[model samples]
Target: MRARFVSATPSEPAPPPRDGRQSAAALLVARGTRRLLRRLDFASVTELPLLSGRRADIVALSAGAELLIVEVKSSVADYRADHKWRDYRAHCDQLYFAVPASMPLDIMPQDAGLIVADAYGAAILREAPRHKVAPATRRAVVTRFAQAAAHRLHALSDPDAAGAEAF
Candidate 1:
């Protein structure tokens, strides 16, 4: 599923009430990461798409212009079922996995950084090694972020946006 921005705004409606353990966990991870990244002064958009057709759970752009992609895993099954995360590296300067505190962190790949998160906030457990993205790819991702953010903002102000086609 595409990563969606969580907000109380009518344009970007919040996710439905949690119905299961996995959904609850995902909400927590996404909320926590949103808090964590903002605290670090990075502007982020959730559910941003990559050129490869995969959606990043969260895409953050730092003040220094570094791109960061976070993959949120709510359960062991969530992690195990996903192997496409590697594809995200090409679109980001750093890639990290966000999970709840109860998860077995040891199972996470040693190469990727880790974050321990709850509904209110998150802390980085490990810093992912930075591999600077190519200049062209960085430009594309940044442009996409800008467009998505703009689209969302426009939707927020447009009462008819609900029925409008996505850009």
Candidate 2:
């Protein structure tokens, strides 16, 4: 995804559009993930680029340096269309599927963790089994996440820096 700066004032600027504005359900999932992860003391970055050329909906890092990736499915159609979610597991210690409470959880892959979310909050219905990532892989993911966050923050001030791609 590409971002363009739209400055409303010389001293203040709006954040770049995120994935060109997420779908309603996706927005809820993101907000809920933030809320939940915060309680667990996990810092998260959204729309994280992965090694497989796919973007994780949310990538979180815990105090112990454990990595978790969550893929948000907004609807039945969204869930059905994706087959690449498995690719996310290779990049993180644990993987999860996050969806609105109304979504049919039964259809989600049993091996992945499950999160039932609303616009306000989320609850982990199942814990994902950890498959520890190699140290080299962990370093790569952490570097990507850090660079993405830094670039976005820099864009907020220098706007022109928004052109730097995270991947």
- What TM-score, computed on C-alpha atoms, does each candidate reach? 0.84, 0.85
Q: What CA RMSD would you report for each candidate?
A: 6.7, 5.5
User: 1-167 in candidate 1: lDDT tens per residue?
Assistant: 99756355567654422324347679779888889999999998877878889988889998888999999999899999989999999999899999999899999998888998999899998999999899999999999988877876666556377642353
Cα deviation of 5 in candidate 2 (Å)?
18
> How would you encode candidate 2's per-residue C-alpha lDDT over 136-158 as one tens digit per residue?
98999999988888877676657
Model 2 backbone overlap count: 0
